[model samples]
Target: MPAQVICIGSVLWDIVGRTPRNMALSNDVPGRILRLPGGVALNIAQALAKYDLSPVALTAIGQDTEGDDLMKASADLGLDMQFVHRPDDLPTDCYMAIEGANGLIAAIADAHSLEAAGDAILAPLTDGRLGSETSPFSGVIALDGNLTLALLQEIAQNPLFSNADLRIAPASPGKAERLRPFLTHSRGTLYVNLEEAGILVDRLFDSSQDAVRALLDAGAARVMVTHGGRDATFGTPDLITSQTPPKVNVTRITGAGDTFMAAHIAAEIQGASPSDALNAALAAAASYVSGDTILS
Candidate 1:
């Protein structure tokens, strides 16, 4: 089947430890450990697949055992992997995070392989397979800030992306500033939390509405700011909308943002209104964090 969306960035394993108790600095607690196929881009792709949208993965994965297993797992989830770069010398990437009843305490991302592979993963875009310079892809593309700043900047200015509906997200708060290049991109829409939005604008925001206005003032063509259990706001220069997520116990927090972005994209593609799309996204994210939806 043809790919309906392009997901670009890290494709890796996630080693997550979850504990029911609230945690603090230097605290150790007994918890369940699980290893799953995850990464910002991969998580979004996996979520898109759940909506029956064929998503093509554009990222680098090593040719080792871990990479092979990851490929099998992604295929099982129905992600198109024909465009994934597999380098023999590099090792598969991984992300580790510790989550408690409170929230995410700490996390580390080892995306060196993806950074080292550089723009090799994007060959399909300019090689006439998906798109070329003369004819650019006009479909939806989801990008993550796990990519190096240089590459992200290039994509922001490249003509190949000028016509695409670009949806981007920061991999984490630490890497949020890497997405500054797209602040003025005409077709780009950013998905970020309150903190991440604040980082991009270099100031603290009190609420999602404030962050939305700040990001738009900072030249974002469109932006969505989520404030955990508070309201989530979506804004463009012409119109701004907000939706409050359903209150639910956050049993997990890792992939909730990705689920929101994917669900929002799918809803918009299905011709939902701005208000309806925001509601759908918030509901999907609430389901994910509440552990009500089964994770693949």
Candidate 2:
């Protein structure tokens, strides 16, 4: 099947340790540790694949055992891996996180391989394989801030992406500022949490609504702000809509935001109304956090 969208950025393994009880510094409790295929782009692509969107991965992976496993896993999940760049010298990247009852305690992302690969990872887009400047890709492009700031800025101004529907995510709160270039790009739509919005706008927002308004005022053409279990809002200069996620016991936290973003994109692509898309995204995220299987 042809690719419906392109997911760009980190593609790696996630090693997560989760404890049902609250934890603090230097405390080690009995918990389950699992390794899963993850990363912002992969997470979003996996979610889209669940909806039969057939997203193509445009990122870097090492030519190692882990990278081979990730490719097989992505293919098994129905993602297109033809565009993934695998360099023999680089080791596969990974993210390690410790999540406790209170929430995420600490995390480390070893995405040096991706950073080193740089624009080489985007060769498919530039070398007339997937797209070119003269005939820019017109499909949706989901981008993550795991990319270096230089690459992100280049994409923001590059002609190759000028005609694409750009959906941007910061990957995490720490990387939110990397999305600054897209704030003024007309084709870009930002997906961020309240904290990320605050980072982008340089101010604290009391709610998602305020964050949406602030982002719009700050030159974001389109924006979506999610506030964990609180209300999430999608907005533009002319219109804004909000929805509260269904209440549920939180069982997992990783990949929830990516799930929401993917669901919203899939909903919009399927011709859902603004309200319907927002509601669907919230419900999907709630289901994911509540430990419901997202894909059949």
| The candidate that achieves the highest lDDT relative to the unseen native structure | 1
Find the candidate with the highest TM-score and give its number. 1
lDDT of each: 0.92, 0.91
- RMSD from true fold, candidate 1: 1.2
Candidate 2 has an lDDT of: 0.91
What CA root-mean-square deviation does each model show from the true structure?
Answer: 1.2, 1.3
The local lDDT score (0 to 100) that residue 155 gets in candidate 2 is 93
Q: lDDT per residue, candidate 2, 1-296, as tens digits?
A: 54489999988999999999999999989999999999999999999988888899988898889999999987888788998999999999999999988888999888899999999988888778888867788899999999999989999989889889999999999999999988766559999999999999899989999999999888898999999999999998889999899999987888899999999999999999888999999999999988898732
List residue ranges in candidate 1 displaced over 4 A.
Answer: 1-3
TM-score of candidate 1 against the unseen true structure = 0.97
